[model samples]
Each structure stands twice: as structure tokens, then as C-alpha cells.
Target: MKDAKLSNVFAYQNITHKDVFLSQKKYLSLFLNTIMNLESLKQLFLYHGCDKIYVKILSANDNSKNQVYLSGSYDVLNIFPISEIVADSSGDWKKERFKASVKFSWITDEGKITDAPNSQFILYPKYPEVRFSGFLQKSHNAPSELMSKRLPGRLLFMSVSNSGKILGYVSSPESEVTQSFNSLKHLEVAGVFKVLELELKINYRELLLKELFRIHSLGWITSKRLHKSGNILPCVSSNCGGYTLEAELGISANGYSEPDYLGYEIKQFKANSFDRIANEVITLMTPEPTGGIYVDKGVGNFIKSYGYEDKSGKEDRLNIGGIHKSGVRQPLTGLTLQLIGFDTETFKIRNASGSISLIDGNGNEASSWSFTSLIKHWNKKHNQACYVPSKSVKVPLQKYLYGNKVLLGNGTDFQLFLKQMLLGNIYYDPGIKMEFVSSSKPVIKRRSQFRIKSGNLTNLYKQSEIVDLLKI
Candidate 1:
């Protein structure tokens, strides 16, 4: 299988101290081969109660010691959780990261499942990369033949389920599965791995579009919310517009970034008019802070330290409301948003211990959201989203009518979110409030919202489009 011309063309430095060279066409061909239909391949994962699937073709250097390289960006961190970054003494290699915790298993062609408890994903933020290892270490019934050595061209299909387990399947060398996947899969990416946005029965995007089209045919729906327990409740408030859309779609409220319907977040925005899908402030995410005074102290203490008194002539009330952008101080809160460990100019994480922090006047950390914490939420909810502009009615028994024209965004990385933050297209607007401030235990409601205008939304995704359900 060695042609000196091809071998010399793609030979890369093999880290295993071996004379092995993989072809440029191996990666190049896989990128362009999009005709392989993988419906059968998808059904296997679906049968295992998995919802999202990602693929990574092994390289000659992708071994246990070297680890499987994930990505240079924070996107893969969104899919697979990483352990806290352990900074070393020297800055030569930058940062070394490990998997937080994961349960990995191998599913055979016969549907047999075996656990690979040692399986872990490591991150090298120096290169700002992630790698895979431990799967073939002391594991039985695992793909030792494919993963144990410096093997190239073996396909790895890893899926994430609602239960948080990462299940995987490796194609046998020269198996028909690899051939079909190479020929028929969509050229989509998920972090370091290629995203398998399959045409399956569940995770397929077109199926969701068709369902939305069905709801579009319904004209309008009564304002109501579907409970996660499958109960229907009257949604008579401003949020009823979003609630009604979820109800019509038969989806239950799954908190932040958890897939709402068909592995996509269902977002309903109150549009002034649907003719152009008017610019509206969309709540991107509401992840709580994972560090600084927010975690060291309490939310009450943090709020008292940084928040301002309510300006609406309301007694015994405090509020923190307004826009907070990177490197800029907000007058009301008296805290500036700062991005640490990241080089916004290069769009890279120069340090793994980086964070989005709110620093107080005296240079104290009021609250900080670590890269590990934010990336988990950023793309999980935003990776794929369907933004539906809606108009609500309260006079006629409360109802919501969605526009036939919908905006569908796919393939986003947390890096895009950060990139937008750098440009001031996205800002942190908190609606935190404390009532009965003088009481023994004052009630506090915290809402940390990162919002963006609908017009600027396209900058966050790799592919975005206005879909007319009627046309479909």
C-alpha cells in the first residue's frame, strides 16, 4: 500500500518512533466524500438511547501516549467535559488538562456493550488542543486492534446521551461501515470530530423542520406550557409565546442548553413584526458563575458587594441591571467584565485557566465564569438553534402565532460566542434583584443573561438561514 510519491506527499513526523506515513488524500478525501448515507449507522446509536453522535477518523499518531487531538478551539469542550486545567511550572508546554469524569463504553456490531472505564480526554491548551486516551488501556472487548497501536483510518463514532454517558463504536479495518460513512456522511464538524447530523428518525434537522411546518399549518396555538412531567399548564404571562411554541412542538422544558426538540434549542422571540424578523434581544445563556466571590462567598454577599440600589423608587430592593462588556466598567454595578487567559486578538485561549470575570473597583473578583464552566453551556444550548419570531395575544384568551419564516443556525463554537463578545455584539445583561433586603433572609432572584440582537446573531454560527416552512 506504499507509493513513494503518495507516502512522501503526506508523511508527517510520527511521534511513536516508527516509520509510518499516512496519506494526504486520507484526510482530504474524507473531507470531500459526503455522499455516504448513514441512516443505518445512526439507528444503532439511537437504539442505545444516544441523542448526539460525533465521528473522528484515527491518525497514525493518535495513540494513547500522544492522545487523540480534539481541537484548538473551545468547541469540543462543549461536547466532552474536561477536568480542571493543571498549570505546570514552565510555560514551555502551556497547560495540561484532563477529563473531568466520563463513562465510556464500546458497542459491538452485535449490540454487545462493554465498559472502558479508563477512557479519558486530555487537553493541551498550549496548542489549545484536546486528545483521547485510556480507552484501550486494560479494557476488555474494546477495539484494541484499532486503538492500541498507531493505527490510521479506523473510524470512531462517539455518541452522547441524555444520561451523560459517552458511548462509542469503532469500525473494523476496511469494514463496509467505514466505506459507507466515507461515501455518505455530511461534512459537518463537532469540535475535533466531525459532527454526524444524520438523517435519522430523531436527531435529524429536516424532521424538526417538517414538524415546525406542521405547526405552521396550525396558524396559532393556545398559550400553554408542557411540564417535564408531561402535564399541561396555562402560560398566561409574557413568556407564554415561547411556552406555546414548545407546547405545540410536544417538547418539555429542559433547563439551559439541554436539547429541546430534535437536538436543537427552540428559541421564541417576541418580534415587533415578522415581515423582517425584527431585531430582538435574545437570551443566549444563563449559566451561573463557577468562581470568584460568586463561589467563594455567597450570591447574597456578592450581590451586596457589587449590586446597586433599585432606582424605581422601590424601597428595600436592590437591582443589578445593564450591559456589561469586556474590559469596560459599568457605572451601576461598578464592575468591569474581563476576559483572562484568552487572546481575543488571536481568537485563542492563551491559558487554560482563563475566565470571564467581573472585577470590582478595588480589583477584587466579584464573580468569575471559568472557561471550563462557560464552554459547557455556551454551545450546548447554542450549537444548533431554531429562532422563531412570534407574536402573542392576551385579549383573545392568550395565544401565540409563530412566523412561517424561521431562522435556523447550525454548527457554532463557543469561540464564536467569545469572538462576538470581543466585538461588543454580545453583552452580559443581568436582571438580578433582591427583595425584602432588610428582612432576616432576603429573597434573591439571579438572572445572568448573555444577550445579542437578532441581526447580529448570524455571526455566531457557521451556517445560518431563513427557512420558509411553507416552501418546505
Candidate 2:
């Protein structure tokens, strides 16, 4: 047997030390008596290689028999990215299955983490919520006492790692974790998640604001970006404002969809003044088409079919740029934007195959974004987004000065994005063009943007806060 580890630990990885494994009862006792507060629980999750720790307060309706209801809405998808869902034929009911490579475990008081191989996260698109099944099957030291009965208020914690694997822990109904859950339930994080933030004795909001103030103190900064190799490079593009902000924050974009800094997505947009922070159009997303002639035939062919000559009279160049709003026909492309299989009255998706499509005069789908495809990029990036306005000057070189008045938005839902699309607040404005058209292999730049004006920015989030750095 390995050396016996301590029953109580205040550090992050004290519970992770290899020790003589105790029985399930002793582990339960340790878990109940030890300092297993929310912060320590988060530390334990960190020790087990998880960055995104999502804890849910289990209700009476949430049980092993009930398949452990995750959420009633698309809130689950916002935190943890659930991949594309395909029809499941082996099931008795009409259901869909997706790729969830989660390896779950039940951590014991004996400092033992046992794996549950049969656990699965199921998604019912018809109800639009995710449920967990096959849990508690063939697992050692599993929490059968609370899970077997109809017990509410039990806390279920799922910790997702950088590799997309999930480690799970369920707290007893009468434990310290439960007590923390009840007291901190009022301060749950954005979406269906219930998190108790005792880290550094500073809440996430304060931490984010503190960092922003530090960044603002530095007046005009040179346009530069952080390389993945831990180096800084001179940035000279229209996107230099955002790139400079990220570089100042020391955020090296290694091609991950994680937040910019301190769990907040930093959005720096160009503006004339600080008062008109959201006056300019903000690009919500720029995902390529999942289906239609844009994907089936080719980008080149799609540009040739729908693209028009450059209005500036540039030779051998074709461009497709215009505002394509809901149910409106774009004159340049002659394509009308349509929403398929969505109930506008109910503001819900009636069909999983629904799409935000651009249709040609002949009713052919010129470009399309399926509901599943859009869900892949929606809400996963910015649950808590910080919008900073900046003014650029290009006299000697391009330099930007960030504004003191900043807007912070929290709690985004995919359906809310769709609702904005239906309300004509969100529209597709593509800057797709083909240069060197006379050459054998022409150069194509496809920028399919779904943008919204600054005035209507509050419609996308559940909460919005404007903070002035000059005061704080």
C-alpha cells in the first residue's frame, strides 16, 4: 500500500496524493468532515485536470431513473460545447446522439477516483435539453445512496479538461458542498450553471474590471499581436484593435475557442468617441457555410454564381457585399434570406434541420447555415464578454487608445441570437470577393459575417453592465 495521505487538505492537490486507499465509508466520512467548500472543490477539480467546472443542483425530478436532467434549454451547450447531433436509430423513442468523449469518475474520501465507463451525456433536440444516462453503471464506490432515491438539492459537478474530457463529482445531500450550494445559489454563474466563486476572495467581475483598468492606464499602445511562440509581432490589419488588446493582455491565440483573459471575452471595436461605444456594427460571428452551393460545388463557383463586378471598377475582381436581413431580397445578389423550420410565434426551433439560408431567385440554396452548424459556434465563446471602444491614428504608425467607458455583457443564449435574427437586428453581411479572376487559380476571400448594430447590443445578453475605468 502507498503512504497514507491526510484526510483534510487546504491546498489544491492535497487530495491528489497517492495513499493507502480507504473504504467507501471512510471516504464518505472524510468528504463530509473535511474542508470541502466550493473553493476547495474547485481546487480538487483543478487538481484533476479540469478548467471548466460546472456544478448543477439536482432536483427531485433529476434522478438516475429520470436520466439526470441537465437543462431545460440550450444552456448546457453554452458552457460545454456539445458536438453535432445525429439521429439515433437504435433507440425506441425519436432521439439524437452526439460525440461526447467524457470520462467520468466518482472521487472518494479515501483520495481514490474510480471511473464510470457506462456514463453518457444524451441530448434530446426536440426538447432542446441535454440529459445524462448510463451513469452509476459498473462503477466502484458510486453514490448509490442519494442517486437511487428521489432526492433534491444534491450537487452534481462536472469538470471539463482542456482535452474535452469530463470528470464528475456528486455531493451528498447533507454535506458542506450542499451547504455552500444553498448559500451561493443566488450567485450562480451565467446560464444553467451554479458556481460558487471564492477564488482569491475576488469575484470574476471584479477581477475582469481590475485587469481592464490596468490595460486602460496604458494610453496609446503600438499595434502588435502575440505569437503562439510566446513572441510579439507588429500587427498591421483592420483587426489591429482587437489584436493589440489581446497582445496587451498577454493572450497568445493558439487556435483555441477559450476566452481572451480571465474567463472574459475581450472585444475591442473602433469608435469615434467613448460615449458612442456601441455605435459601430459588431461582427457577431463569421462561420463558413455548412451546406448549399457554397460548400457542395466550391467557393470559387459560388462566388462566380452570386458575385458581381466590383463597384470601384477593379479589373478581374468580383465582390458580394450587402446587407441581407430576414425576408429581405439583396439587390446585388438577388437572394432573399429565409429562416426554415423555425416557429416565429413561439420563438423555438420546430425542426432540427432548420436553417438560416440565402435563397436564389430559382429557390436554390445559395448559402446556408444549419441550426446544428450555427449551434457549433454559438454562445460557446463569450458568456461574459467585455466590449472596449478604441480610436486609431496612423500618422507615424497605427496606434490605438482604449476608452474608459466599457460595456460588459453576460449570459448569452443561442435562441436569443436567432430571435435577434428574426427581429431584423442581426443580418448577414458578406465581404466575399475573388481577386485575380483572370488567373488559372483565382484568390478568394470568404468573410460571411452576422453583424448587429451597437444600439441593439443589449438584446443578445441577459445582463449588461457599463463600467467606467476612470472612476474605478
Candidate 3:
């Protein structure tokens, strides 16, 4: 029974009037025989509980010879407990009994079940083959440009290997589709895969510029109207602008998991707004400090040791806000955030200054980071950033002003950024603060920051483009 092919076990028949007899005894016998056959079929297939089923995915181009085994479960009848099938007690067997349907479930390494697998499998009993198909069509609701141009093909199977490599098989002759699957499988596993280049439908830069110009053409849009109408507006707060731009662009505003504003970070600021004066320093990231005197201390303790008084001069308040110039001592901490081991001119990190060292509380220098290491971390988040400038109008009722004239910062120049930092034009200012309410070690709000003057932005970025809001 275990070795029996599905074709040999399941039978299909077409009954005609001649096959039936009106005699009550004969009719009863026929009914009993039909039930017995169904029972036998069920027993043969579910003899081992039917909880575990293995799928063999073969390459159609290779004549179904090369294959990979993927563990899965069939959800037909009462075979799998993931869904239940109930029988009716009304004695009308044909209408009351649960209909048998084909369903398949595959468990991912992350313990997630792929969606709607039952509909994705196209079984060919005559060919004695079950092919998983229609994934590209069924899984994505993307623009046609982003969709595969080739004919929809059968999905072979995909599985994660023991070595953490993703293995996939597709029964398709289209090399492009198969190659795309191969290249994107790793991103798929991480759950952050997105084909933005295709999904965008148009040149991304052109689209963004067009949108920006449309906004600029409006002259001025009231913040009250934007907030009430749920429309896109240039927000005063950088944080608020980040969220508003996402909503305007039809992107989800909730998590860091997905790319922001279609694979680019949208940063809005008033014209001539700098990182320190505006308190809007570009935060590369918020990774925990790796080492130094700060390593042993908790965030609260570290703030207590290094924090200074704000304008109010409150006791035990830590204000990690001050100018950090290369070679020159920092204004607040008296320590320099120098480019020690890197060639300042070439923007390269050298082996001698392999690590950025800082003097600790005990007067011993501790290695903080090497230029090579920092650049790697920075590159991950700074891939593409859009800096926008806005014109602000004071709102008498609100704490912040309304930003109207939103201008685009075409692109960032990493090399210019390094050069600026070396020349004291750009600086690192950690805007961390500790609020001591009842003296239970205080609550800390840490904002790791890197700042540059608003006027010096041209040196760190490419030429600006003005977006006309009215046209969009």
C-alpha cells in the first residue's frame, strides 16, 4: 500500500441508467459497496495517520529527474489537523458528507505557513505528478512592470537547507524568472525582499521629483488642512515629516522592517536648518556602544556620569549636546571625536588608527571604533537618503511652525561628508538626555546624532531641485 501510486488507488467512474436497478435489496447492496470502496481508499491513504507528507519538486526542463524533497502536509479530508472536516448525520450521504479537496501546507524555517498553498498546487493524476504552480501570480499584487513578463509557470518547490542556504526549484523554461528567484531567495528568507525597481513602474528619481514639484507649486498648503484631510504636507518636525511622507507615498508607517518611502529615507528640514541648531542631527543608527568605560555602566549610570545641566541647570541632568570637532577638543566633554587612523584627505581608515580611542574615566584610552568598521555600519543605513528643505509659517495655536516650501536635496555625497567632518564643518553631537523625576536612577532618552551646519549642506550634498507642488 505504501508503494502504490496515487493513480492505481483512486478510481473515477461515470454511471448511466443501465447501471442502476430499482429493486430495494439490490439498491442497498450497491450503496453498501460504494461506502466500502470509499472506506478502503481512505484506509490505504491514511494508514500512517497522514500527518506527514513529503513533496518532490522536479525541474520540468530536466525531464522531472533532478528533485528536492520538502516536508509538507496535505489538508484534504480529515488527513491533517490544521483544518477539520465534519460529516453530517442526516443520511443524505452525497449532499451531507464533507467534500474532499486538495490542500498542501509547508512549514518555513521561521515557523510560518505559506499562504493558500491548497490553491497553488495543480495535481495531474493522469501524469502521476503533483506540481506546485502559480506562485508569482498568486503571491504578489504588484504593478505589471514589476511582474514577470514570461508566461506563468509551475512552481517546483522551495526549502531551506541544513547549512541555512535557500534551495528552490522551478519548472520553468524562462531563464529570467528562474534567475530572479535564485538571486532573491535569500532576501525572501529574511522577509525584507522587495523588487522596488520593477514595482515603481517609472524612473524612481523622476517620479520623486515630479511629486516634489507638484507639492511646491501649491505655494503654501495649510498644516491644519493636511492633518484634517489626511493628505501629504511638509511637516515641521523631522520625525513627523518622516511619517507624513510615508503616508503620502502610500507606504506603511509602522516599522523599521520595510524600506521607507520606496527604498529611500525622506528627510525634511527648513532651508538653512543645521543638525545642532534645529536639534535635527542625522542619526546614522542606535547601536549600543561596543566598549570603553561606558561598557560596564548601564545607560542610566553613563548618563549620570557624562550628563550636564540643560538651560534650566537642574541637578543630575545629563545633556550630551555639544560640538565635536576633529582634532579639536569637544566643547562639552573636552574629548575629540578625531579621525585618528584614517587618512583625512583620502577618506580611508589606516591600520595604525585601526580603532578610534577615547580617554575613559580612569585616564586610560579605550578603543571605540576603527574608520573601516564605522564606515561599514554607516553604509548599511545611508544607502540612499533624500534631504528636503521646507519654508515654515508660524502657527499661532501650535508649538511648532508649519513648513510649506519643501525643496529636495537631490543626493548625498559620502566623500564630501568625510571631507567636511575632517575640516570641522560636520560634527557628531550625541543628543542624549536623562530625566530624574523621583531619583530611581532616572529615565534616559538617548538620541545618537551627527550634525552639520545648514549653510554647509551644499558641500555635503549635490545640487538641490525645487519641486512645484501645484503641478503634482
Cα lDDT of model 2 by residue, 203-253, tens digit: 457656766788788989999998977789999988898889888777765
Predictions: Cα RMSD each? 11.9, 6.6, 21.1
Cα deviation of 217, candidate 2, in Å: 2.7
For candidate 3, the TM-score is: 0.47
lDDT of 1 by residue, 1-472 (tens): 1132123222321222122212223323443454222554565565554546788888878766677776765556567643333433244435444344457888765555788887766655555566777887767878776776787888889887545678888775488778777886457765557777632223257767877887877886888998977789898777778788888777766675466765688888888887877478888778888888878998888878887888988999888888999889999999999887767667766665678889989999988888777765666667789998888777768887888888999868766787788788889999999999899989999888888999988999889999988888
lDDT tens readout by residue for model 3, 71-161: 1211110111112222222433222212112233332222223443322332221111223333333332212221233334433333322
lDDT of each: 0.72, 0.74, 0.40
Best by TM-score: 2
Backbone clash count for every predicted candidate, in the order shown: 10, 1, 18
The true-versus-predicted C-alpha distance at residue 38 of model 2, in Å, is: 9.1
Better of 1 and 3 by lDDT: 1
What is the overall TM-score of model 1 with all chains considered together? 0.79
Model 2, TM vs. native:
0.81
Give the Cα RMSD of candidate 2. 6.6
Clashing pairs in 2: 27-109
